[model samples]
Target: MFTLFRKEINGYLSSLVAYITIGVFLLVMGLFLWVFPESSILDYGYATMEGLFNTAPYIFMFMIPALTMRTLSEEQKDGTFELLATRPLTDWQIVWGKYFACLLIVLLALLPTLIYYYAVYKLGATEGNIDTGAVIGSYIGLFLLGGAFVAIGLFASSVTKNQIIAFAIGVFLCFFTFIGFDSLSQLLSFRTIDSFIASLGINEHYQSVSRGVLDTRDLVYFLSFIGAFLVVTKTVLGGRKW
Candidate 1:
């Protein structure tokens, strides 16, 4: 597992993918928090915390796909995938190895945001009276949200050898999963079913957890989503030799 993990990590770092992913994430966050006139830029009396949380999901929508686009696609495209498959590694090991490499990049991108938190801390009227709990909660939600996106992206990459196609499918699928159910809920004629549909979306659970209220159901939903997608990715890769 460590060997597979190191290989994937090296693959990402040796190429432009890791740098681009981190650069885009920071650029988007900086623009929203410091440049956009309507929100963080004008100091409209709203906390940066809100701006950060609100803009993060959309930034992640693009960044995660970029990070995962070449994970499996490049391997298959270059014919190195079969070599790895025939090695001693199991499907699960490869899946998790790649997953952790992407996850590490995501986490590294997130680490710089601590500066924002510190900036907010010093900028507060009082000495750190800001709602740190909610900020921490939102960060947790973002991590889980990114994890699920990575899983979906891994699955998408496994389905095709074209990196561009993998990226397109991964982005659309992530966006759909994030808001599709909520949109469906709005269009439903029956009120009871509408609420159920809304509840099924990632946004609903994400919002709940972001508020510093860690509901078990929301946690379960994220875990289940990640697990389900990872399993599917494993299955897809497993059938490569068949």
Candidate 2:
């Protein structure tokens, strides 16, 4: 597992993929937090990172899929997976190895955004006026949320050999998982179970955690959701016997 992990990480770092992914993510974030009028901190005139927190998940919904689209898809397409699978690695190792590598890239992408936080921290009328707890909680929520999307993206990649198709599948699945259930809860037909239905989606748990509450229920939901998708990805890899 560690070998596969290192290899995958090296693959990303050795190429332009890691740098490009981080650059694009940070670029879009910079645009939203600084350049864009509506979400720009300059326009808000507050130390709060509500703009960053509120819009990050949506950015992640697309960014992660683009990163993971080639994880398994490229391997499968290039016939490299056959050789890798022939080695002693288990399917879980392969899945996790690639998963963590992609996740590391995501974290690296997020690392630069701390500049925005610091800028906001000092930009306020009072130094450090920003809500530290909420910022920390939102960062945690974003990490877990990104993890869930990585798992979903891996599953999407596992199901196909075409990177474009994998990317599309990943984005669609992430969007639906993040917001579809919440939307479904509003339907008149599901009024009785609306809350319960909403609770099933990432948005509900994500919103709960973003409030700086650190609820165990929300944490469990993210972990369970990630685990379930990774397992499904392993199953998909297992099914491809050769």
For candidate 2, write residues 49-145 as lDDT tens digits.
8888889999999899999999999999999999998899899889989999888888888888998898888878989998899889899999999
User: Which prediction has the highest TM-score against the true structure?
Assistant: 2
Candidate 1: tens digits of C-alpha lDDT, residues 1-242 = 89989988888889887888898888889888877876583385644478888889988888999889889998999999888888999999999999999999999999998898888777766758578899999999999999999999999999999999999999999999999999989988999999899988899999999999899999999999999999999999988773
Model 1 deviation from native, Cα RMSD in Å: 1.3
> What do the candidate models score in CA lDDT, each in turn?
0.89, 0.91
> How does each model score on TM-score?
0.96, 0.97
In the predicted model 1, the residue pairs found to clash are: none
Number of clashes recorded per candidate: 0, 0
